[model samples]
Target: MIRDALLFQLGYNATLVTLGAMLLGMAAGVGGTFLFLRKRALVSDAISHATLPGVGLAFMVMVAFGGDGRNLIGLLGGAAVSAALGLLGVAWLASRTRLAEDAAIGAVLSVFFGFGVVLLTMIQTMSAGQQAGLEGFLLGSTAGMLRSDAMIIAGAAALTLGLVLALRRPLTLAAFDPGFAASTGLNVARTDLAMMGLVLAVTVVGLKIVGLILIVALLIIPPVTARFWTERTDHVVVLSGVFGGGAAYLGAAFSAALPDLPTGPIIVLVGFAIFAVSLLLAPQRGVLSAVLRHRMFQRRVHLRQGLLALAQGQPIYEPLTLRLLRREGLALPDGVATPAGRARAGKALLDETRWQLVRQDPSFEAAAAHYDGLTPIETVLTVDQLDEIDQRLPQPHEVSRP
Candidate 1:
């Protein structure tokens, strides 16, 4: 009967926790989609880690005010302050120094987290009468969440959603091409700040469920995975929310089932599992798409090679059969391989391969007659191109030049 009661309570609390986490994750997914597009995903990481100190400070303030150690208001107050300070520091560092965005993010994250650790340790030692509940903010004890917490999360989620809807146009335009956005009269800097602030808020909301250590997973993985399923940004945002929220719900449920397991890590792992599956199977941007594209490209390359040799009046592989050409998608209409087909296929292949090979050889010209076939009679890989390609090859996967 005790076990049954515990299970029932667990189920109820789990549902509440999942609801809170889903609200948080949905906001994160929507906001983070823009952040990822803006190439500011690392900023989300910085804010997530930086919020730790704010949480610690909030607890300290609550204790000073004679409030209990488990005050959710204190925790969130601290998180907001910490996140705000971290953002200011990042902005100041960028303005004062030549450091890049990633470097600035890393520096702020380390400084804030280190400070949080010290504050937490100090509070733990000094507050012997009341056991510090601040550590839960670091690892997220969703099982301990209450109705108040759910309400708070729901409010924040609503605010975040409203902000995203209001700023969608500016955010989208800025993310895709900021220069163009600026030209069209959007205040790129303001748009950036607004979007980042939304991300920070979402991060704090998630911190109570997933903690600072793994919150970036919530911000990045879902949106990235969703991108594979759709080309349209609106659909991507919606799908990303579903993916993130669903993962949060399932992860919270699983964590409730296993007493020894931590909720934060489980949530992160669940999110990653979704991302991995999407990466392999999503329609456009999945691993399977890349693999198929590569195979098709390779076939065209082989056909181009054959056509090039023919154009140069040089010898190709003895008895280059129609089957060989067909395998490369360079097959002629009949059994006989035509120069035109071979050339066309070869040209298409070169265009496709350029993405993966551009840095290696600037002078690697495709066939003039067929980008797939042969370059002009005198055109060949230049000496400089040969040297560049040689130097650029991956150390363990070097290809020899003809």
Candidate 2:
């Protein structure tokens, strides 16, 4: 077989890994889209790290029951137990302590992960060779995974995705406006519980690839990247699933290629890479788009500033510098208006900035004619300014300005 036949020769295993990863990614993308929007991104991190003890305990229980040490059922049991416990701990801390949600999540994460590490160490020392393979589960080794494990992952993903899809409307409303959802009798707490269940499933399925250390990234990043691509909830979910599925494949493939590399980090890196691209280049929310939009906005504002100055009869060569307007390409060479460019600029300003021309000079009849019988642009406000005002509103009333 050729050197790269690892991908080809292990076609069966490769298919399983790809399928499992796809399922896991799809589940994560669907649930995580809501989680990210809800600002509970770190909860996934908490659950992921806290699932360690669950895995260890599951393995120990399996041994007690005479099950195979490598059984996925036991592993899932452990992860689920620990995940529930972690959520409980997070909730208790938030309710009992002065610590907020983030603080509680961080606290539980550190404690649970620490306990897991200790338990892992104990298993390593006590079980010898039989337990040696268990260590791979801690960081995930996709190469060693069996077809059975992939089936379990895929099954869990399908169930989770189906449930979420079924309850999509309520979940979306609950995430965006809990009070509104509550007022509408949407069962906010039940919706939240369902979301947690989904998160739990995602954590368990993803355990084989990113393990505890990196699983949250898998859940959070793909949705975040996908968010940049669209503002519609359904579209976001679809795109997130696509990005997540592709990342899972690449992550698994890359790890399989470099035998020494852990699958979890590889998957995480793939997710992060996708997120970075979205953050930088996505049409509406990306860094490039934001920068371009801001530049365009600033230029419009500057042009309007120049017109306002000229409208006030400030000598263009005097108080206002010709070089500044020239640099902006807004002024004429002799400081008189470049009627065509200025009129074009004015029309653009009205459309772009929504500046209200309360009273138009009869001399500007040509431009004034454009707004006949229309409401003055003065009634409109910049989106940014609107956002600032919206921020002052109560939490429940904060409409999505998007």
Candidate 3:
């Protein structure tokens, strides 16, 4: 069943629904990248929550006007309007009042969500609302979705993604340095609005698949997961879209294959699963890589200290250092230095002497300031400088023997 769903052989409506879910996920992921970069992730939460009242009101108006209260386009249009108002309110409060952006987001999200719940309750008591299924918008329900509805969702998602792509360069510039972007003739305010507009489109379009609440997960998790794998913003946007699309596609297939499973929660779970894998396994930024790098550095430190000890004729007291020296064939089990160890030790001692002489020399002050004991002295000094420093050294017979 799972294989059939993945292969898109799961009947016409199911296939369309899955495809729609994937496009919506990609749109959410790519559009949300700028919001994530701008540190306004909470705004998505506010906008999503703010959408509820619009949906309830739109339903009420449709019923009052003798139209289908469950019309997808009308409901989504209402949601977009309400979400826009909520966004504007947040901006106004943050910019014109004493409240911080987060406080404004909290205010808008709570008030609008509370009003929406009230409207939903009122809707439940109405005769026409008994079988409305409006509650599905809160957590998304793709069960019995029609082919036309699926196509609408997929089309809207694609449009949103294209707009995000078209504005990528300007958005990227604004994201990193708004001041520089402004100086370079990019309207920072317009760029922010464009970003918010894209986010709003994703939020509205995703209502039927991921729902308002779970849509925030769609918008956020992909970008964060992508960030674990890259340092470049463009790369992050691309990876985020891929991750989001894959998660949604797989999640929808899983939901279709398994009975009594919901699409929204399943999609969210899949996104988090991707995040977990990236966090633990990404090459440069993952926890496993960090641990390996640390271990390598520790090994280098142990080997360096062991060599210096051998050169000084000191007893190897640290067990790990001694074991490391033995593993490298630089020492014996009895802590005695091997011939190769003695040779390495001489070079290590000489390097140490050169560093000390360079630090003590007034002429080498510039080079001496960069000394971090692990750096080779040769890299710090030119050949001429080394020769000059060497001239200040004592004769070979004057050097102490081990």
The per-model lDDT (C-alpha) reads: 0.76, 0.75, 0.92
- Writing each residue's lDDT as its tens digit, candidate 1 over 1-402 gives 324323346656566766777777788888889998888888888898899888888887777888886777778877988898998788778878998878999999999999999999999899877777677778777766787887888788878977897888999999999999999999999999999899888888878888888888888988998988999989888988888887777677777777567778887788889998988987678999889988867664665666544444445553443456655554443534465655754554443444246433344435222333323322444557545544654563456766
By TM-score, highest first, what's the ranking? 3, 2, 1
lDDT: worst 10-residue window of model 3: 126-135
The all-Cα superposition gives candidate 3 an RMSD in Å to the true structure of 3.7
Model 1 lowest lDDT segment of ten: 369-378
Tens digit per residue, CA lDDT, model 3, 1-402: 999999999899899999999999999999888899988888999999999999999999998999999899999999999999999999999999999999999999999999999998889888552688888899888887778889999999999999999999999999999999999999999999999999999999999888888999999999999999999999999999999999999988888888478788999999999999999999999999999988988888888889999999999899999999999999999999999999988888888888999999887889999876667789988999889888877688887988
- Alpha-carbon shift of residue 289 in model 1 (angstroms): 2.8
lDDT of 2: 0.75
Residue 111 in candidate 3, Cα distance off native in Å: 1.1
The reply for model 3, stretches above 4 Å from the true place, is: 128-130, 314-316, 349-402
lDDT of 3: 0.92
List residue ranges in candidate 2 displaced over 4 A.
1-9, 307-313, 317-334, 337-402
Model 3 / residue 147 / CA error / Å: 1.4
Candidate 1 wrongly placed segments (more than 4 Å):
1-11, 300-402
lDDT score at residue 164, model 2, on the 0-100 scale: 76
Model 2 worst lDDT window (10 residues): 352-361
